[model samples]
Target: MLTCAFLLIVQQAGNASANTRNGRFIVTITNNDQPAHASLPGPDTLAPPREATFAEGRLAAAQTGAHSYVSPADSAVRQQIEELGSANTRKRVAEQDPPQSIVDTCRNDPRADGGKGHVFHRLWWCQEHGFTARATDTNGNLLGEASVNYVAIAWGSYTSRDILVELQKTTLGKPTGVFSDPDAVRFIIGANCADTGTGNGCAVHYPTVNKTLTEWGNDQEWHNWLITSDESKSTSPDLVLRHRWNLSASVEVPGGTGGPFPSPTPYHLIRCDSATYFAGRPKACINDEVLPYITYEINSAPAISVHDVAVHIREAQDTPDLTFPPSPTPKRIPGKYIYENPKDNGLRRIPEADEGPNRAVVRQACDQLRPIPSDEQCDEYPFASTMEGAASPDWDFSAKAVNGRENTRAGGYLRWYVFWDRMLYRDMDSYYVNIID
Candidate 1:
């Protein structure tokens, strides 16, 4: 049985439109709330899209009636009528009937509770980009109204679906094949790392390079295989990774007497750090190493090329407040050889020597190094480890060393520290072989 759930009456702001010339009224009836005169069967026994009726009256009369029910005050009734004027004179009208589609979609066809007296009656009016629904009482009194815009809903759904699909693919362990093509790697890095005036916001990055990097890095299947042989590590750790590796593969080696570019094809590195764990196990240890290969041509002087590598070692420090020694180091790793300029804080320093293979060229370059004036705070570049908490501290480094050089030239020396984490083995080999060949 079609039941009235609610009733709604809307006042037309202007003359009624042609379609609503008879005036518009919305009345909701449910089998559970059947009026005394209603002879409809229970919701479960009646098929839906059935028509139902409701009793409606002037707003003032309804109010007066409700008050009279509470208290039979003759004087109060007269005062209300005098203030509200003649109820019969009010031009109360019903909303046009709801379209058949709304009736079919929202009407309770059969009692969801199997005739337990609970049934829903909903009426909707389709609009341009969306639709609106209203619930009304038996008297055609407005109960509530809800409006939904389909365009916004669809957009939200598409965005959510895209993210979910990408996330699933990432979790499934897809191969990036970045190592196979140096040019492709370079292009990706350039596209992502270029200064596009967007201030390196994550939202801006999500649709471009960051999305790809995240998908590639989150390949759980690939990580599982990458760490399968390690007895201590059962799965790839959840790394705080980013794309900050820079290479000199595109530029002429500073020294080397013009032999060849150190790297053959231009490629970038994916920098990552141990910051989180899974199943109560530490994901990755902070034992990775960074190396910088620099070539300098001083005033037409013979070009000098130097390669240096460094590993971060946690040192124990004594403190007065703690029973055990506290590591004096702040949660954020500081640049190793690099120091924030106390003066302008605009400049940085790199070693001038050209001979050592494991020399200190830039200190803690991949650490949480910030730009000068401190207020301009170093662009954490892509992600900020502090936001995730000290317990999960990590930084992913990319192999775009040329970007580091560019950063240095731009006076973002602290930001340039990411170059320290370059993947010398894989990327450097490509750097040398591609150029030499």
Candidate 2:
């Protein structure tokens, strides 16, 4: 059961693709309420090598649908939105169906990126979708959040099983050795526009309108153990006490020079914070648009540190049969549905899931049997804290100048996205190592 989770490249578009053992897989989304779908655009639209049937799961998205852009009643944009789903929608004719190698519980099987917990979904989706996405809402208004598959594993496995076996025999088996590889990180990048805010008229389903960024780059929220693993010391039991800011990170603005003033150099998408949404592409931004730029950076450090020290706690409590003993064997068991913490505002959680008022007392969680902590919002383009902090009463993403000036100052902390490659990813590409999430 792969819960729907994601952070996107700067803003939302239709599809985002990521690299994998089999090349790449694309993520398709409909944040605008206008339900949209996609297919590979080569010779014959590549059909999902393995088509897994979705069971009777309740829809987490709103049912509202609309088709317009910038302005709700814009007829021309509305027409363009209408053609999103049905446009170039391709389906393959012939491909052999392969046998699955493993059988995982509903809560775990069919999972391609779950080893990373919830936040990974965001990073994975951002990478996959952004790789080669063409964002155009089915409804121009960008206000139609009907229903959609948050992500689809479109690479080699074809089916979840094919992907899982390789994972089990390799990564899962030797988590210590395999997960350390930097190339292990697999991902892609996409492009599109962003709106202002609620006042700008972005609906609940496709609240994606309003202020938008370019790419949603992320990685596995900081796992204390993963952090220490890279360090020579603290090698026992894979230390799990480190604090990790799930999506907290630094960004590398593609084609960026030194500041955010000149606009993303390439201006991936015209962003205007004045007229509620974008102010609709100003001539200044259009000409100054560069590739990617550091638009937002998480202000928090992604590492967890203990504020106090503790002595031995009665040799720790007895544990369950959590390990596989000393035998070379595989384990299997039944499980339940995974849910989001009632307190979580992310769609990654369910409608009927648990909820509470206080952030601390309200444990954001899922119903899954495994006590997996989900960093659901990490890796969303720009950044979640950045989003929650975007239009705060104190700060404003719309501020033309951080200090009331026209152009941003030099050495300014221009926000940007950090496209993450997971610990298990098989690619060892170079990186800027901007932030430490």
Q: How far does residue 70 in candidate 2 sit from its true spot (Å)?
A: 56
Candidate 2 lDDT for residue 423: 11
Give TM-scores for every candidate, taking all chains together and pairing residue i with residue i: 0.14, 0.16
Best by lDDT: 1
| Residue 392 shift from truth in candidate 2, angstroms | 49
Off by over 4 Å in 2: 1-241, 245-437
Computed on alpha carbons, the lDDT of every model, listed in order, comes to: 0.20, 0.17
For residues 1-437, what per-residue lDDT tens digits would candidate 1 score against the true structure?
33212111122223323323333333222222222212332333222222111111112112222111101112343344222221111121122222234334333333211111111110001111211223233354443342211100000010010000011111111212211222221111111221112222111112222123233344332000010011122122232222211111111111112111111111111222232212222221110111121111112211211111010111101111221112354333322211111111111122223213112212233232433333222222111211111222341221112223223332222122222211112111100000000
Per-residue alpha-carbon lDDT of candidate 2 for residues 1-437, written as tens digits (9 for 90 to 100): 43332211122222323312222222232212112323211111111122111110011111111101122223343343233211221111011111122112212433233211211111111111111112112232121111111222211111111110001101111111111222332122211122212122211111111101211122211111011111122222211111111111111222212111101101011111111111221111010011111111222222221101000000110111232121133321111111221112211111111222212111221122223224221111111122122222221111111211211211122211121111110111111111111
Worst 10 residues of 1 by lDDT: 152-161
